[model samples]
Target: MTFTYTVSPKDWLGIAPIVVLVVMALVLMLVDLVLPHAGERSKHTGPANFTVLPAVGLLGVLGAMAAAVTLFFVDHPTSVFNNMLGADAGTLYADLIILAAGGLGILLSPAYLKRLKLVHQGEYYALLLLSMTGMLLMAGALSFLIVFVGLEMFSLALYILCSFIDKRQTSQESGMKYFLLSSFASAFLLYGIALIYAATGHTSFVDVQKFVVAQAHGHAPILLLVGLGLLTVGFAFKVSAVPFQAWTPDVYQGAPAPVTAFMSIGTKVAALLAFMRVFGFALSSVQSSWMPVVWAIAVLTVILGNLMALGQSNVKRLLAYSSIAHGGYLLIGVVVSGAAQQNHIGASAVLFYLTCYLFMNIGAFGVVSLLERIDNTGSDLSDLRGLWYRRPLLAGLLAFFLLSLAGFPPMAGFAAKYYLFYAALVGGHPELLIIGVVASVLGIYYYLRFIATMFMEGREGSHASSTHAAFERIPATPRPTRAPTGSLTRAASSTRGATAVAEKPASTKIAASPLPATAEIEPTHELEGWSWVALGIAALGTLVTGVILPFWLPQLQQAAQSLLK
Candidate 1:
């Protein structure tokens, strides 16, 4: 009694990553609240906080990432804390992806926060770290308590992040909408967990799986089955599966681009991890009951997500729908993982796809964020009319990312898609493979259309009139004026009426003297230093992932195999 300790250093080491992140978040917030601002500019974008907080936040992410990698090789059981949280290789893999997204988001944040004159730099980075921490907890959750705690923790942080731009009404709407919908989903998940515990007398995943295995197929209690169904709803909502994806486009479009750049990928990684655990392993014995439901949702999401993305003029909204479609692709792996004898292959595909997606998706969103910072014009198609002529490097980058997203050959996206679809065929789900391929083909149209818009120039005569008209919206001043978020959707409709009202003679007069290429638009090659670095790294990741497919596949396969145990 005198010498023994209840909580030892080894126990803390079990959750070393979470501890590092939580401590970092607390330190940043305390520094922000305690530090004094001596000047007007410092009050909003404090020199101290802005410069140091993001760097600190990035450091925290890297530290946690390193800790996760360490946990992978440590000579300890994967499950720690009485099997409440798992430091399994699968969870560690998901944590790395979440942290990668957060690091990139931090890199993209400085300019966005400064440009918007947002205060609370400490809270911003702190919340981001906390969110990443929660995602890690959720991914590694071994008990229902940890799952709900992790879910609520991340959800609360995201609500604040979503409405961080309080000056914009749309941000408020996005936050409120997400809060309502997500809470409802969480309730379903919690209720389901309770039912399962009541039916099986176990709240831990391993115990629950043991109970399920003991019960003969189709003989499981009704309450346990219902609980499983409810869990699916919660996970489905998180992944933005169809019929539950209404919040995605608006939230992605309304949230600060930096936040979207991270949330779009990180959230999926966490949700899918929990989903695979609960469905692919814990409840696999009863897979015959749930596979049909998941299969249907996956097909619907793939078809509808691409179809909805086809007409989106807003790049963020387009990417949001694109995200929903990718979710469907990820789900295919989940469904196939339930297919007997193909568990490892299907699960591994999901991990590899997520690794590829983290780079390509964030890079695409970063370019959009850059355009927003530069011109306050990324929210519309008109902003992209002659992007290639205006910013060749940026246009080229966007083109490469879009092609990767489109699954063009030799890009990571193609390799990712290839593995996920191939898993379906290996799992005896040829129908899912067929449906996914067809939907991917449909998605290529919109992606290529975006690339074409960016790479191809418009007619010279039209540039003087139409392009000049579009240019009028961009301010020449150093600090551009702010407008309500999502105003473009409304303005686009009004522009149709105004287009008819404009005099033909004024347009003809402008077209007579077409602007020369030299003076078309000032070059904006000089982006913020950190943003350029983030984009450069993302570009390298996008290309290198595809190029080094052979190298990483074994690691992912090894990670995926851990989930089955």
Candidate 2:
């Protein structure tokens, strides 16, 4: 017997965003093959000459976003490909967020890659789009098999992106660690899926849900409970929830800033949405079996994530922990959504908060990316000291993002949390609300400390006569040739020479006290044009999302209704 599979136009329409991204990635990869390397270009050409690949990538992301918006407007929730994937408001909303993150990441990469002499432009942009496709797939997946496919697709791409900085041992190490740990998580998730399939004789979420309801009315199997536990562990690891979060700080610190920013928001949005779908729908009848476990994880993640972040001096690591804490807050929505009565409130809160987080988190990391120097330097607290005096605009924008992350009033973060906690209270989960509130309060200290360090702290040694004393220590690079013997050049020469000589052996020590009065070190890295654009877009997004909450909230509510439907 011969079998034929019938495909419909609606199925293709359901996946238009993914199709667009994949095509763009392929085109970009091919185009990159023909593009000349930077070294082949004239020395006088600026980095803009190498921006074509990123530009194409940005266009692709924008195109995908447009497609997602169109799909949202269509407002049809359909499972395509034999119920393997869905096209619905929830998936489209996630697509918009993922595409935005991908765009911002692309915008941030050109300058960073150029500064660090990393020139695999084709691979970078292609992998970014490909990763985004995986996230989109995860957001739309309707079955366990599709989820696994999407998970591995993005995970593989991320492993490569994390290791893109070949010169940095830390980057390589991060890649290896993430790969090993994430593979283990994937295995657990897969085994859980397998166990669930064996228990229910189905991998489709709808069939699993039916089986779960039947089992709930009869006798539920212990194997199903075990599968649920394993699934929770897998998702917890992906979302960086407490005990599984040890890799977060190291990976975020070691990866390039743009990659960290993209991963922070993209992975959370994808994993959390999948988590919600799996538990809120497929396993809703058995929630009582897993509710307490999830509750404990959420509580621990919030408390420990905040406390650990307090002592961090590195901006990236601090944000990494902050992300964990945010995951805890999002978990409140997950718990509330699992209850059949409060699903809409919980789901809407999650979508809205993720929207808010996408902007504020990416904006904060954009500032960090702009300031980061070659070899992943310049993210330390000391680098941010007196930042307001140097780059007032950037400092203010960063402060806004930090305040938003801290859930300060009149910002998106505060609005998002208010809805989230209120939903918890309405859902009869007062403990989660209380814990989230207390954690937000404790989290305030670190965010404010960073702001204070930027605006209130003095330069390292401002009272000293030597410029070198006032500025933060510079990284070691080859010394410039001797300048003219004029007073101005004398100070500049002495500054460079001092830095160079300091790196020499003790036997080659130079006199430290005779430097000219004017000797001052300047910040080595300047914000490039693309970085400025990325920052401006991110800041605008944060401001608009916070300030215009009333206008868009209804749309989010509608999307949430569609999600429940």
Candidate 3:
């Protein structure tokens, strides 16, 4: 027996998106080494190239996205690289979603990192790009080996990203917990892969499909059955399904908001796509064996996840549970796609919903990331009270995203859920649709609750302390227009006189304390330029995807046709 090997330019072209990202990650770290003020930046004492590193990362993501889009025009087989990768339309589509998430997540990062005084600029962007590469790899995987490798690659990057804020204990805890639990989940998935290899003597999806179809009884063997169950547990944890979701709220709450923002879409898109490829396509011949278990997880995750989210006061935790529930909604696609009879409706709906979700969900987390101050403060319900009064733009955007997440009409979230539920109904899973709608209704109360807090007349707190709560209660004063030269001279003279007096004596300080040069007023910080870019794109996407979904739906459905066959 011989294991044939060959490398072609076309093979590299098939994985061009991944290759671009890997190159960019290394380039970013190297670029950081040569930037001005590198030593001061590392020590957190001077000006840093806050603009350059994130910009480089964004360009890399854009490049990867371009590579992925180019693959749409290239003719490629279902599997490439010795049957380890997929270059089909579905893989390309999923790659676009993952890249979109990575791009938006990078846009949200620089400001958050700066605000938190996290000065590790180079490694941060590098890991982010590397993480996106892993997601792209997972999206294109056709073999169990590639899937596990991709999972670990992305998961390891995320573990470090989650703990990047050295000043925060919560961040460290989040990273550690994610490392431990994810490793445990990886073990289950890997063991399942090993058992499947033993049973079928293959690891590629094509080979596994052939072996499963060749089985005599139209049923799975006991070993294959156990392996499938373990596979379910592992993927279930990855998707944050119920009974395996305890880590989600904790990790989401503890990690930095931008990291949470990225993982919400990136991790789910990668994990669910792989899950769909494995169960919905590869082992689809044994659909009767795995569908019931996936169906059960979906139902519980949809219902229980919503129930858990109803009481969260912290913005991150609320979104975490929301992410978990949405994961269940996405699983409906997997459950239904197992039936080759309905064509690829489930897979297409998954793709379409993922596109919509990337906008609405990331925008919501982007706002949270933008709002976070020192030590990860300013994300509580109390901090959001009267937010509309303080930052109407942010408040309005949050409402729009929350409404979308709640499946309200006219928002992308509504459109995403509609297509997903339609797929469930069309695929003969009416029960999932019914349960999902009920859970979504439960979800609305929390989203709306947070919205209500933002719109409150004033944040509920006293003015004794100079905290964000009190800051929200204060009416924003209009900044006065610049004065003429003569008036400015007079004002400057008066300010100097007052400062001189305040510095002179303790008795003069009593009268001029607020006017003292050292006395500082808490600034009503403006949204960072990069964050505005992210929010603008997200807002536009949230609106446009819903409005244009009808046009795009058919195109996505055509891409999904490959999976069901």
- lDDT of predicted model 2: 0.81
Error of 2 at 68 (Å): 1.0
Off by over 4 Å in 1: 1-6, 34-36, 39-41, 216-218, 341-343, 373-376, 459-527, 551-559
Model 1: per-residue Cα lDDT over 264-359, one tens digit each: 987899898888888887788888888899999999999999999999887889899999999999999999888844447887899889999999
Ranked by lDDT from best down, the candidates are 3, 2, 1
The lDDT of each candidate is 0.80, 0.81, 0.81
Per-residue lDDT of candidate 3, residues 379-477 (tens digit):
888668788987899999989999998999888988899989988998998988899998898889999999988886575443322343332232323
Q: Which ten residues in a row have the lowest lDDT in candidate 3?
A: 499-508
- Model 3 clash count equals 0
In terms of lDDT, the poorest run of 10 residues in model 1 is 509-518
Report the alpha-carbon TM-score of model 2 versus the true structure: 0.89
Estimate the lDDT of model 1: 0.80
Model 2 lDDT per residue over 190-217, tens place: 9999888888888988988898887766
- RMSD of every candidate to native, in Å, equals 6.9, 5.5, 7.8
TM-score of each: 0.87, 0.89, 0.88
| Cα displacement (Å) at residue 278, model 1 | 0.2
Error of 2 at 550 (Å): 3.8
